[model samples]
Target: MISGLGALDALSGPQRFGGATGPLAAAQPSVSASDFSSAVAEAANRTIHTLSQAESVSMTALEGGNVQARDVVDAVMSAEQTLQAAISIRDKIVTAYLEVSRMAI
Candidate 1:
């Protein structure tokens, strides 16, 4: 049930990444560069974890380890979607950096 924008939404909130809770989530909307970097790192880690899980499921299924076909399909789909989101975010960040660099200062 993860939407296309779910990853992006998660990055905006500390709760999703298991960081500080309560009042931290209620803090101001401004985000520092360090926070942005941490978010990117977290997103990459999540994508990597999903891809690894998919691979593990596929391998188990291939080895006749009693893994269900539907489980494999679900894992693969989740990994694919997560990877797509990461790539999209990376592209947007690069595009924004390029745009900023080109601006006359």
Candidate 2:
């Protein structure tokens, strides 16, 4: 049950979060970018792991592998909740960035 904005496991697959490269990596950071990137990558990995687990559970149930309904439901629900929370966090970040960019500096 990962809660809060730190649960950024919504974006799954090969595309990962905070695995910045090229210019992002090349640029100097006022803050410790490595720590932030590592944290984001960790969160993404956790989310991917959870999603894969849920998918496997569902597939097992479909394949009649003696999977329990409760287990499937719990896994699916956890995945869904994680995804929604991550999305919300992403949206907030985007909004905040936009607001900052719009500021008269």
Candidate 3:
């Protein structure tokens, strides 16, 4: 399971032991914006490929007389899962942006 804020802290900053007086420090550099965008794009491409393959599979199943209804259902389910994953990633990106905007700079 995802660890939420704990995971975020681990990724971005140092741990606080008590009443901290400043921003958390980190041992490594933060992820660059270009890297994040590229990663998002790659995920989107995977989703598109999955959706297209699912559609093709469903169509092929329809054309073949021996095709089972379960095959088409599975294709559709796979497409739905890809779409849900893409949406979830997008939501996380948007939420991060909103959080950054809320921070005092």
Q: Which of 1 and 3 is the better model by TM-score?
A: 1
Task: State the lDDT of candidate 2 residue by residue for 9-54, as single tens digits.
Answer: 4333223334444555435333355655666677767777878899
Error of 1 at 62 (Å): 0.6
- lDDT (Cα, tens digit) per residue for candidate 3, span 1-105: 221112223332232223233545333345666655555566666677778877888888878856678887877887887677667867988999899999998
Give residue 2's lDDT in candidate 1 (0 to 100): 40
Show model 2 residue runs off by greater than 4 Å. 1-31
Note the clash tally of each candidate.
0, 0, 0
By lDDT, who's the top model here? 1
Query: What's the lDDT for candidate 2?
Result: 0.70
Best by TM-score: 1
What's the distance in Å from true for residue 84, model 3?
0.9
Candidate 3 lDDT score relative to the true structure: 0.62
